[model samples]
Target: MTTDNRSTLFSPLTLPTPDGTGFALRNRTILSPMCQYAVDRQDGVATDWHLQHYGAVAAGGFGLLTIESTGVNAAGRISPRDLGMYNETQEAAHRRLVSFIHSQGAAAAVQLNHAGGRASGKPWLPGTHGGSAPLEDGGWQTVGMTDQSIAKGYRPTTKLSKDGIEQIVSDFAAAARRADAAGYDVIQIHAAHGYLLHQSLSPLTNTRDDKYGGTEENRFRLTREVVDAVRAAWPDSKPLGIRISATDWVAGGLDVDVTSRLMRDLVKNHGINWVDVSSGGLVSTPLQPSGPGFHAVLGAQIKRALADTDAVVSVVGGISSPEQAETMLRTGQVDAVSIGRAAMRNPHWPAMAAARLGVPCEDNPAAPQYWRAEW
Candidate 1:
């Protein structure tokens, strides 16, 4: 409903690269990282659920598809079954999924993450009707930057020593290698949503007095180091992206101004190509200003703030329609749009959007066995 007639969301978008590799998207549509939690732990396999689920989106024509925030460490998982990149067993499953997505002409992207303070919890548990697993036994007893998280009912975390920081950076590089092996064309570092890296970036959670905390520069040290390490390990042919909270939306949290400055530094200095703008996920009672285009406005502002930086920006959060997305793109508020919930609601969203905008494209790209004559 909040559409401007002359928008560019339907137009083809080509992203810039610091490494001089050329990549062009058929459109500005992107699929943000949304957790599917459909992995089998025993064999580390992705079920037909993954193929069918993601295949639908690729077939539907989203230009870029970012898989969920895959855990770099097993204990750092958001849930026991969350997708992972720590070992070969997990990497093989992702490879199969990516092959199918690429065959459909959608760019495959992966979000590598570590859930520091917010790790391991059952998404749904019954009350009193049955017993459940603790985070250590499959519930959330994860560590954090300080002792404050434990007081808030989260797991007490070991304050990361310099060596621990180095290991995390190593984990991220390994994950990027796995992504490269798995045929991912794009890699996104998940530093947003109150995760491990974001925790280090925030003063509210990260209370360390050492180089990893204190001043803003110190706070950002971990993220910068991680990005640099990942850039080194990842192939120069692929574009690397970073997702940031943009605005924690809570008092004493990382706001857009800080995030904007960080975005500029990450892009200009560290060789990051894109910044996926999402908000919240770091609070027990997050102050989310829920509505249409709320986060998009933040995206617009951050993009403007970083006008000098060459990094391409993608905005996600409550974007429900192509019309709304186009308005933002046409105005150059953001370089691209990422839709999650809406795409889940309609796997054919991109196809529907193309039709609405009078673009030429296929509705579904799955095997004929799945979507035959109907498509």
Candidate 2:
């Protein structure tokens, strides 16, 4: 979306997409992926809750909408109820979701992930089964790419063998193909938030001695391979993005500078279209900012650092206002601002902002059959 000083975050910005697809930001606003913990246990199917949640978000007019984290392997799940794309039934359910979102004129993307050692845990709630559980609680032994020691309630995983590594890559590629077949517009390889891929990226967690560990290059190898494999399986016309923890937010963890270089490589070397910037989630706990637009500055810094690279930067976290989102885009700091908790609280936020800013509302027009007199 084009904008000037008075854009107020409602302006449209044309984002550069990957080969073969058109992925323009309808506006500078997006509905960031947030795990809804909604899945059917009987068959790993997406229930009415999933449909209504995503359908409303599409109707809200966000430029791009990503489905919540979905596991590529059974043990990769964060919670038992988390969605999966490892099977045909799950793929069918996702196809229905994609159809619903496209009907609203918004793009649909899915974040494929592996929970790593964090899998087989209880629901994310206070005093309610935090961390990985024991076998008795229906938690099978968790695994990772290395033999690094794990904390309490979590078991150290058997390091993935050469064949296992190949299998993991295949799993990601298969999932990407499924996403495409299911009618998804964009495909995101989840390498952030201390998940399987991020675990491989962080030196703090990946302590392997082979080609996949020790040095930063080795540490980044697995993630890069996954990116390459997913891109190969996914159609070149569609945009492929990766969400990364720009900073682990720990003193000893990966720094933003190194990650900035990595982003450049992904863009310049591998032709990645965008880097969805997020932070922390490396360890059980890490330092993080509490103020609004906390991650915006980091995203801006990354954007400036990669001025020579073709990758567009997108920032998440603490973005709650139309004005703030607009300012970020107008200043040329971030290509797009994504809303997480805020969008969850108010699904019509995009439509409301469009009305306030006097921009067109082509993305979210409520059907007359549903809300004619109310409008």
Top-TM-score structure, candidate number? 2
When summed lDDT is taken over every stretch of 10 residues in candidate 2, the lowest stretch is 366-375
* Candidate models: Cα lDDT each: 0.78, 0.78
Clash pairs detected, candidate 1: 59-365, 134-139, 135-139, 135-140, 143-157, 144-157
Instruction: Give lDDT tens digits, candidate 1, residues 57-121.
Output: 88877888999888887756666668889888789889989999988878899889888766665
* Model 1 misplaced stretches (Cα beyond 4 Å): 1-7, 42-44, 124-137, 150-153, 361-375
| TM-score for each predicted model, relative to the true structure | 0.90, 0.92
Q: What ranges in model 2 sit over 4 Å off? A: 1-8, 15-21, 134-137, 149-152, 284-286, 360-375
To one decimal, what is the Cα RMSD in angstroms of model 1 from the true structure? Answer: 3.5
